[model samples]
Target: MKKNLFLTAIIIIVSIGTTKANSFKNNIYQEIKKDSARLSELDKFWTELSRTVREGDFEGYQAAYHPDAVLVIKQNRSISITEALDNWKQGFIDTKLGKKNDKVEFRLSKRIGSKTTAFETGIFYFTSTDSHGNPTEDYIHFEMLLVKRNEKWYALMENQKSEATKEEWKALE
Candidate 1:
């Protein structure tokens, strides 16, 4: 009787452990699914953004930002989306689109967080290709806060810096 009781108790303990393990596994799976969905949605926005910027589509690029967005530079000055976009559109026209040898690439270099909000770090590379196909690259590195509103991801704020030390980047973080 004692041996049988001990055996039964062991079975019960093992069952509980197994149940807990399964629960934890399930929770992880659910989290993965949730993050996967969030990534898909965010990727859609980033793809559109990259294409717009790369092609120097000023109107499309302008549309990507939320009207209420605020952009901040390393100098700590803040500006409205409209003003920023206006400045950028003019720059794009003069510098990027008209030059046949100029090719632009934009990429979301890093990101963190979830469905509603995220911190995105991106790089925009402008390359000048010679007729021989040798290319020179200039890059803009930027970080921004993005929010999903009305089922669309919009840039809510941006902070741009040039050539910061590693410690400064950590401080910014």
Candidate 2:
């Protein structure tokens, strides 16, 4: 009887320890999985964003940013968006005349800082025409901040800088 009681207590203690260890392992596994899942979700946004740009769907392109967003250019031109119905009007004008933003190449690097927030580093290469009607290419290195709100991802801020000291910044209110 004494031997049986001792064995029973030993089994209970071992079982408890095993259960705790497994729980800890599962938690760590979940965290690693969450990180990968977050990256995948963030990557999906770029796919959609590229599609919108390629299609020249201005509205779709605008949808990528939150409403009341701000855009700054070259650290000199800053614009706050509020019911910006004709915000991209100038770009449209240039495109209509002769200038074209016809091609783009996106190289994206994403990092998941949290379950609801992420950051992206990317280089965007744009092909356009020079003054003499020749093909010219320019690239911009940009950093972006994004947040998941209402189960949807939206860009909270985007800033771009070039070697020529050209900077473009966008923020949301």
Candidate 3:
């Protein structure tokens, strides 16, 4: 009788342990699924941003940012996105008028965030035509802070770090 009681206790302990392990695994799986969904949404956001810049959609490009967004440059100066937009408006107008062409491409090195926010580090390649009609290209290192509001993503801050080499840009995924 004592032997049977001991055996039953061991089995119960083992069963409880197994159940706890399975519960933990399920939680981890759910978190992974949620993260994947968030990433997909972020990818869509970036794709739309690229399209706006390529098409010179000034309103659409501005819409990607929050009304109170901030722009930081090389740890030197900071300005409101509205101010930056004001400075950049002529470029958009020129592009829209076909007087100039512009294109931007981003390659991310790191992204960290939850469902509602993300901080991204990457390099951006910008190509444009100067007033003299000369083509110019630049690779800039940048960090972006984004937040999701009302199921839409918006840039909260854009930190343009410094210049990057083409090889450096190519190194990041």
Q: Top model by TM-score, which number?
A: 3
Q: What is the C-alpha RMSD, rounded to one decimal, of candidate 2?
A: 6.4
Please give the range of 10 consecutive residues that has the lowest summed lDDT in model 2: 164-173
- 46-93, model 2: which lDDT tens digit per residue? 877776545555666677788766654445555654334266544434
Judged by whole-model lDDT over C-alpha atoms, candidate 3 comes out at 0.92
- Separately for all candidates shown, the number of backbone clashes (residues 3 or more apart, or on different chains) is 0, 1, 0
Highest-scoring model, lDDT: 3
Model 1: clashing residue pairs? none
Off by over 4 Å in 1: 92-109, 127-137, 164-173
TM-score of each: 0.75, 0.65, 0.92
lDDT of 1: 0.73
Instruction: Specify the poorest-scoring 10-residue window by lDDT in model 3.
Output: 47-56
lDDT (C-alpha, whole model) for all candidates:
0.73, 0.66, 0.92
What's the lDDT for candidate 2?
Answer: 0.66
Using alpha carbons, what is the TM-score of model 3? 0.92
Candidate achieving higher TM-score, 2 or 3: 3
What is the Å distance of residue 96 in model 2 from its true position?
10
Candidate 2 — number of clashing residue pairs? 1
